[model samples]
Target chain A: MGRIRLTLCVDDSHADDLGDIAGAARRAGMTVEQELSGIGVLTGSIDADNLDALRAIAGVTSVEQERDVTLPPPGSPVQ
Target chain B: MARKSRKRPAKKQAALETLSVSPPEQPQAGGSAPATAPGTTGRFLVLFDRSAAPQAPNTLRRVANLSLASAADFEDGIVEPEGLGGADAVMLPDLAIAIASAPPEQTHALGVASDTGILAIEPERVVYTSGQGWPLNTGPAASADDMAPLDYLRGYRDAVNEVYDRLTGQHDAEAELGAEAVTAFDEADATWGLQATRVVSSQHSGRGIRVAVLDTGVDSGHPDFAGRAVTGASFVQGESVQDGHGHGTHCIGTACGPERPGILPRYGVAHEADIFAGKVLSNRGSGTDGGILAGIQWGVSNKCAIISMSLGAPVQVGQSFSQVYEHAARRALMQGSLIIAAAGNDSRRPARVAPVSHPANCPSVMAVAAIDERFAVARFSNGGLNPQGGQVDIAGPGVDVRSSWPRPTLYNTISGTSMATPHVAGIAALYAQADSTFRGRVLMSMLTQYARRLRAPARDVGAGLVQAL
Candidate 1:
């Protein structure tokens, strides 16, 4: 399957070592985009087939497909 | 141990005699028993600053020239009436309250000497049971020869009638006042939302509190925000903090706009709150989870007490909340920041009601639903249909909400869960400022606890309408 953006939640055990989690995630065929250390989250893109590999990483908890939020156009009465 | 009945002083006895003999029809103010009042003991109750409780006895002695018996000296902290003896006051150290038998003038002097740690001084009122019988023995026992059986029965009848009349009269007055009050709030002095939420009467202006509104950026140049402290940042690539879309400015206006706007009808809440505008959503009002995550990180790093996200993606009925977002929210709470988001406007009401949206569906994040001026849940507001984490936390006035918008369109009236989110956020800032320790999860609990419970279901209005302190 083609590549899709994803958000990886880092487990509490690895919150202090986000760098290791990031390195592990990258080695598991995922491209790291942003490491939000404050919230213990890592956002990146990974092939649909390699999702399990990223999930199997020691510090990673759950892997979610990135969702886009779109609001109604400015002229709409209900925002 | 048997408790002994203490004898009333001659001065107090005379005061009580005058109060009891006063006419029932006498006006509460300027009545014959003005000094003791109709339903009050002759004693004055003084509340002292907690830190100054130890000095209360000294302060009372100096201000009112009265010696006080300390409750701490008594066994089990119970200050028996007989133990007071000739002392003019008894101090309950734990509550920092002093029950003193002082003249009105002396109590007035104590009130005026506020710096001496006296916070308030008021006459202690006699409270009666609303039930069938009296619970307190407030006065000396009456001797059998003092009254005939028929006269005693007549006295009891009169006392019961008096209490019933007073209770019913007060109830009628409250009902009349409620009926005369504005049935529906409009934009006369303040927005309907502000009046409905009781923000108009709130004394806390969110002074010195930092609130982060992560949406489109805010219109920093808006005249309503002149001289206000505003910090803006853009997480969206190549986009400046200036709001090209008016949604961010509108949300910010509701959350942190000035107390007195150039235009009529005060619309904003948390008037004095410092604004931290984070542009997670772009000028077109679209944003990715990554950008939103960045905004959360920024808000947490800056120590914002409240981070409001009025944007969210609709979720399917059975979908679970994002674990990443949930973790982020928990981390923010640990860092003393609360994340509040919209419950989405995907519902068509009686026809179809949508589940709370993503991110907001996270249990740690507070999901806000919208209510109209009539206190009815907005037709478009979502419900907590999904299990585990999709519950709505609180509701806010949303429909026809008037607030500041980008210049050229200086103000706009909008309706959405989007509009409602900031009202809660602004009120959260007020709570934060009201107590420095009220942060993160505590602030969320307070909002839900003090929320005015609506007649609607909890699924629609959660803990009900969010209220100000």
Candidate 2:
């Protein structure tokens, strides 16, 4: 599995909402690896494949996946 | 959706069976308790880290790195080639192999050798084990035929333990542990006696602890649990409060079964524990990790003390899936909820697949294994950390164990430590209750440290048998 990146952008007014939003995002499936201290950039993988759902959270303005994910099928032979 | 009402919160009751305060109306035949026979403990191939010293092909090793073969506290490992005839613990191979060439006598021998544990073998050879003589037609579930007599015997033994507990009255300390139970404990029979008695009930009965049982809903009305279950919901779309699969019902009943019958602990280890019964798994017992993770979050938000996940996250051993229970567990624990998950019951004969999957292995969660009535590890209890690291934690009764279900069926017998987890959760709750000051992690530590080491040690039987308060 490759490390797929998730990028979330929020409006300045709702900027303080990032922590709670990040917490919810973490629950929804994104891992917060590196945070952009000032401007507010959250990067993590969408392991649960619910990046779109993460975008639906109240404060999330926009969400983007920075890399392609190679998800394996069920019961495939172990490599 | 809605939780069902089952029993009272009183400590003298069984989830189903009533207490015989007076002589029982039926006066069932008083049979002598079953004798605990010495099981076959032998030698199997236990792999050693051999970091500084490379070893031979077939040798037994201790569970801990610093634990040498001479140490009594060390968990023993077994080797297979010489036959597990005299072995107490067998080393598990990374995978499970179906040994077709294994003689029937050998199977019977292995079955009889309670001390002799089964080590898992690799999968390729499982299908490759010469098909001439073995009866691997069905998995362990089908092997029920091979173990039916023993299963019945397990029921017999459990009944005997119940009877013995009754005659002694000096059983479960967790029973009716009211105000006096806290400060004025009777010190004589203080040792946690096995059986439904709450030796460690209040001390561990998850009191005030809210656990989100992501299985079948609770019996909203069981008196044993008056107001015990605060909230309930479902995910199977149309499934109501009814425990259609019976598995979830049995699970919740045990996880938080009221203590009136005197068998299970009565007070809330998590007695006042709130539950969010999310039925992600249908009546047949299956679900998506998405639903489970959602339930995990719900429990976390409600600030559940722990999340009892009596389900398995699938596996091919090395196979990795997006549904990693680790991350969810991490988040849950981060949010103040400890996750207790079941090790899968899929491994069968030779080298099969490793039974543990994502969730249990996730950090800080307790991954429990099933132990049988004999107190030897359940033949199917999944392994961990082999030579001693895999996926097991402490073990509880998972064979022929009777617990609550929905209205009609009332009670049923379930196997698998999935049936075993709530026992640990229950024990944890009890430990929490005994002294409210106890930290969840500390409580877990005390329980594990004091776990009665079983004779039949295996990766599956981690930390041996779990004890009551």
Q: What Cα-based lDDT does every candidate model obtain? A: 0.84, 0.51
Residues B1-469 of candidate 1 have per-residue lDDT tens digits of 1222233233433544432423222344433244445455667788999999989988988876777778877788887754464677889988999987655555656766657877877667666554644333333443222234446567598557657867777434222111123387667889989998899999999999999999999899999988999998999999999998999999999999888899888989999999999999989999999999999999999999999999999999999988889999999999999999999999997678899999889999999999887787888899999988799999998889889899889999989999999999999999999998899999999999999977567898899999989
Choose the strongest candidate by TM-score: 1
Chain B alone: TM-score in each candidate?
0.72, 0.53
Q: Which residue runs of candidate 2 sit more than 4 Å off their true CA positions?
A: A1-79, B1-204, B221-227, B261-272, B319-324, B349-353, B385-389
TM values, all candidates? 0.77, 0.49
- In angstroms, give how far residue A69 of model 1 lies from its true place: 1.2
lDDT of 2 by residue, A1-79 (tens): 4446655655556556768778888888787764432333455677645766787887666665442211112111110
Docking level of model 1: high
